[model samples]
Target chain A: MLFVFTYAQQKGTAKNPFILNPTDSTVVWGSYWSEMPPVLHIHSGDYVRVRTVLTSNPEHLIKAGVPANQIEKQLIAVQAVKDRGPGGHVLTGPVFIEEAAPGDVLEVHIDSIDLPIDYGYNGIGQGGFLSDEIFDRKTKIIHLDREKMLGHFADGIEIPLHPFFGSMGVAPPKKAGRWNSAPPWIHGGNLDNKELVTGTSLYLPVFVKGALFEIGDGHAAQGDGEVDITAIETSLIGKLHFIVHKGKSLQWPRAESATHIITMGFDRDLNAATHIAVRQMIDYLMQTKKLSEADAYMLCSVAADVVITELVDGNVGVHVMLPKYIFVSH
Target chain B: MLFVFTYAQQKGTAKNPFILNPTDSTVVWGSYWSEMPPVLHIHSGDYVRVRTVLTSNPEHLIKAGVPANQIEKQLIAVQAVKDRGPGGHVLTGPVFIEEAAPGDVLEVHIDSIDLPIDYGYNGIGQGGFLSDEIFDRKTKIIHLDREKMLGHFADGIEIPLHPFFGSMGVAPPKKAGRWNSAPPWIHGGNLDNKELVTGTSLYLPVFVKGALFEIGDGHAAQGDGEVDITAIETSLIGKLHFIVHKGKSLQWPRAESATHIITMGFDRDLNAATHIAVRQMIDYLMQTKKLSEADAYMLCSVAADVVITELVDGNVGVHVMLPKYIFVSH
Candidate 1:
């Protein structure tokens, strides 16, 4: 797998980008470790066309009503690897960003996300918020109307598709060792925030050398809490533009979409997460919009929308979305 | 004060709504009690053009940067309300919905919400999410651009207005004496869910005879979480059409907007509130959409957006929003 990696460490441009395919060697099963060797190397401002595969069992897909022929061959091909999880996702890469270092911020612009397959699965099982009441462990195959970007959940139920990667992060600090990929931390793994779709820029604090970036857990569409445990799980292809901001610092992950500035916090306690998210937004507003601490607090109360990013992620997520239109000159 | 109420019971139509003003006779300060005398008795499907008053001091409004002349006189007049709270709002009515009874549901259709004042205030005090960190309690009066439907928070900050009644509901169960008008219960007071704007139907469970309803704490605009403790608080006039669903029942407050179906949960713990909201949505999808228990839970995971309605309201609010468009047949 390392033989297929682009290790030249040359500057990659928009026109000529490094393409990565989801293979057993390039993908890790259910863990984000600082020791994971870099699969590819690219310079700042370079674009990477990355492909990701789902982690669910291929036999389960057929049981869930997906035809055998429709399954992505890469997903079936990658399943033979014996390595699996302390978590449950087959994430692609620990792509090394050459100039990135600790204490800096790595900004990843999610340029586009397109479905690689025309079907996805939603499973309900134990370990969700309603795990006590709902004991049925089953999966349903949802046919994706890729052209229209809708999921046919049932005859009458059609879910709108907003495809995005559920996990995107760099390796944690060396001391943290192989971090379980279930909970998101300051390094930004398994965020499960649906707002980081195409056109959004996710800013994560670089925790180690090369800012070992990784991405996977494709969700065609997902609700805020991901309360039932999974989203419309499927394979996806995304064009990510990576840029490392030298000397810049971020305590937690922050994202900015075209319409709003979003700050996120992940913790077992939702209120503690909310406090972190709100404080981040206040800090953002104080720095960029140039408002006082009090004014920023007041502005967030009156203007920002705080949403549950995902409740089931070990460290449940809370995000504060502050609209950018409000910051315009009169 | 009692003599000013419209004692004659009557049916109100869309063309001829019974007008209820915000005088001491019609408004109750800070409580939702079953024993509170009904100010107006209206039949099912009655339209009430209700006028509401702000609860803040006029002197504070002036201190918050509003011109003294712009302050609504009704707000100043309502200050004599000595029968104040276990909460702080001065709300209008315990208006009797004639056919409503225990086990029934009172469906209040918010037909229209119009700003009656040109200015609103956002005050950050001692009880907010960051109250411990922010000690300076202050208020800022924001200018409302009624024509453009914006609130000028500052020179460059303009908040879009989505007017709503922060507190709205019937009396609690007769056994539960006068309840504080702060935390929302199954009776639905101070939901602070910003999505309950115009063109929405709020279905609240009826706990007492007549389902004595009240409304107040007009917010010109408010974000989710209401972190700093208030929105753009001001006076508003709303056109409310009340219909009593006699045979229907609801466990918690459920609402439907033009675009989505909403379910709410309130608790001091946000996670508990989230559990309640998701379960309510699951129940809702199961009952209305006729999906099996398993499917409903799965559907919520893949489609519903759980949002924080308000964090400062003693019992923090969490609501699940399921888009209505997804429920239609192909």
Candidate 2:
């Protein structure tokens, strides 16, 4: 069974007391949100659904098929949109998991992504990486059809759309502070893994009680670094399932697919991030292949690899991979 | 015919400068470096053989099949092995191509890589991203086998081996200046593309006469960023064949192979780096698909993607590609 949470209409604090911080743990639970706090009970195989919001001003809306020119006008009219309310990613969960705990890795399996027509950000603006010289206009409004599987830039160019969430994190440790959605930490936030699409299993470190997890910031598509500072920001209704492993201390996050073993690295500098990724992979290698640390490091330098995760985000993330064919035990 | 260059000796001078500098145009004529430079006078479709060096302190050495204690003793005996010396990354160039000229991108198709036995290093120390906490001892020592492939850690961990040049650049423009061989620039220095193995076609931007290109600093393998600030630095003997195109203006370097459309991005910031990469790919996409600029840009954001090129080597580079299956000419 899958649980779906849509922020259709929000009530008062009496209904929802869980302030949506990426690192916040569940305290007073109410029925304001769709999924309740700290208990996503499921068997070895069960499907779950998650809904997310956009990172733009809620009061603003771009009707279907709005041209780039008029979109500029609307953006200029609402330059100070942030003054109206709290400015940050607001997650909608703490989906209680009956069988999650510290030292164990929570496996989140994503199934599908559904986006409504009235959802998703629609614009091409300046100040992005390419905006340095390419963007001439203030805004290029985009109003894509809900069924549009691809977006067009010019007459002959077509792009395939792959939508996924930009933010997904479990509650931090018992003592972990309130976390923002800007960076990726042990609990996992803003992990923009492209493969996190349909049919991928993500393993995250569980720190807090019951793993009060939340996910949001859905993106239609985003590059490795989200270099433009924004991907096709969109609201998404996603179906996901969960399986909890008890008493497994994951120093960091691990992801597995049919083809690869990916360890996500989060840090401020690229070198440091890459080191963490490489070391973690080495640990995996040691456990599976029975090699020494020196050999693992050498393997990383020669065979395994490091890839940049996201550079445009506040904190940098890197990914290190150990191809699946090498590990025979699995 | 193919050309190979091996530095029998080192002679640094203004006209024949040894190091590569970005601002300097004189040292721009080179591409990809193994142990030394390839010999001058390479022709299209010709195979070229080259040599490489390892990052070891010349002052240290160890016998074949030495015991672990002996290896440890050698490592503790020496320090300061990171520096390679003034006569570093020598190149072979100015082959005087009949059809090559300014503005065209020279394509270097890598053939194969082979290593010599009795390989060793000076202090495989702690300096990479994980140095702060896990500070391993540094030392210089030699190994018994030149064909050393893997380094063991504990159990279940084994790494693969892939080697390539760390430095590759074209001859400096006729304008004149000395150069440094640390960063990759318009001339493509220290590109370190792992895909640059045998059967890969690398396109280098030509800025001067004869494209007097050169290559050096070969490593068995390296992660995306070379994040530890160093790879498995080693001396090597490699082979390469060159083909030059005349009168074609390529803003940057590009590569193509049977399964990949490799566009390289080098910049100070990740955002700019991604923009450059996506822009080049957009250009490629437009040229191949007959799409306008707008369409190409949109396609890039949606279909084409960013891959971490090298984050550790002074500058950050990204590779963006659109799988061939995603687009086919109508």
Candidate 3:
């Protein structure tokens, strides 16, 4: 498949006149640029593949069973090095779009995440929300054995692994700037949704023409809130396909798997995040299923639920759940 | 089955003093005044029968479903009359337990929730969280059909029903007085956990000698944050069974089901709430499992998740999740 990509070089300046803020929108594209859009349109079962550069090059790892303290020097050694300049987080254009648009929702089907075992557990501290505390003083660099498939806990509790990308967003609008890689906007950049796992279809709002989207910052595994900041941060190869729904507009992103309809809301405060989540779910019910406000509020209380998507991330996010089985769509 | 109950009446005062401020070791004996304790145990199939009173029984649902203009008339009607003090939250508790003590954990298994149809929906005035300005000026009395589920949304989203208890706790262990039954304390009062549904196993930290636990404030349905400040308030008949696990000191209450382990932490601030949740989960892993501190932290980052259990309730509460399928004991 021909995957389109827009490379933002460090020395290059924004051709567009709009000042890109880190919060509002996440992507900027000029009309005169020759490179293709980031979004890829494909069929449900189509297999799409793309590779990404490491956030930091010269990434190091500890051999299996090594003491954690030994890696202290290695972290200090690599903290200041900028490997590929600022030209990171490039997007693979709308590769598979049978039907997608601004008013419509785009469902991305993620299949498998391929990891390169060479630099297994390196490049985790690239400066995000919790990077200073977790990577600087707390955790250790470790490798994951494909066989063990277990996470370490204090008592005897073993954690499981479910990995996905950190930043995956479509271009905002033709007018919005190629925004910073910090906040999540309409086009769905830096969403950091944990449920974007295998067999999940993420429904994103399409703002720009052709939904110029991109997906990178692959994580091996991450907990909700990403409190320690960095997950199993590593370069990964992801295979997925996309389907777009035209003439539809979603206020925010929605995720659906075998379980429920997930409505995502990210904000600075927990309550604000909660409000966004509740409001969107209420709105979803109103528009998609046709319920009144009072009924919608009640439904949210009963069937719909609110979840703290991430509390420790720079921005706390709350997700509202609407179990699909409860209300079947006609 | 004869469920052993301890009924306590104040000797000089009208109300039970134990229900207000519970001591870490004495409140249990206070809530229950009967002789020897029986098997205060409840398992999966057993149903626990509980008698509950109204939240504002003295206040009454005076102007329910009444327009804003009629509220004055409704209050005037009540002014001429006085509440004989029979309708407010009448908890049949201080249940006597033989094996529960401070540092012990009480496991309450919810079997079923039964609600009254007509008198279910409670009304909130304009000053509450979801003020009348946000909602409507009139008192909206939501009627629930016990036979059939009820939920509302704006568009067409139909909601399913899942009923639960809003205020279920062992009284506070610090101070003594007529404490406002609004916030959650060390004993877990007013902790509106929506997931406290059937098939859920809830674990509360035992503070007093016999665990002076009183459960009431049944809600037909409620969202996670309970942002509107009120749930589908109703008088409920709860069928629950209790089991006591000794020699365990959990800092907060915990809940478990077939799929996940929920550890709860309550605090006044969101940050503090999150810390309580994280610390409690860490404590759980440490006490139950055999992992180290760093490993536990990593495990939390990779597997354990924190949730905003009750945000609007006096103190913001967080529920950390430990998925069960990943770590099961043989």
Instruction: Put down candidate 2 lDDT per residue, B155-269, tens digits, no spaces.
Output: 3433345667766667545443445465576677777777666667788877665666666666655666554445656556566666787656777778776677878888866
DockQ of every predicted complex: 0.81, 0.21, 0.30
Name the 10 consecutive residues with the lowest summed lDDT in model 3 chain A.
Answer: A16-25
For candidate 2, the per-residue lDDT at B72 reads 30
What overall lDDT, based on C-alpha atoms, would model 2 receive against the true structure? 0.57
Candidate 1 residue-wise lDDT, A31-140, digit = tens: 88888888888888999999999758778888878788987888887787678777888888989998999999999999889898898999886768898889998788
Which residue pairs collide, candidate 1?
A: none
Identify the candidate with maximal TM-score.
Answer: 1
Off by over 4 Å in 1: A1-9, B1-9
lDDT of 2 by residue, A1-330 (tens): 999977632221222322322222321121112223442333334455555555553334443344444433222333432322111554546576666766778888776677653334434345244656556322233334557676433334334567878777786665545555667777786776665776677888877656766777777766565545556676676777767888667888788877788888788775567667777887886776666555555555444567666654556777886676544332
Error of 3 at A322 (Å): 1.0
Judged by DockQ cut-offs, the docking class of candidate 1 is high
| Candidate 1 chain B lDDT trough over 10 residues, lowest sum | B1-10
**Candidate 3 deviant stretches above 4 angstroms:** A1-47, A52-58, A62-107, A111-158, A173-178, A232-237, A328-330, B1-48, B54-90, B96-133, B137-163, B198-201, B206-210, B239-248, B328-330
Question: What are the TM-scores, per candidate, against the unseen true structure?
Answer: 0.96, 0.68, 0.70
Taking the candidates one at a time, how many backbone clashes does each contain?
0, 93, 62
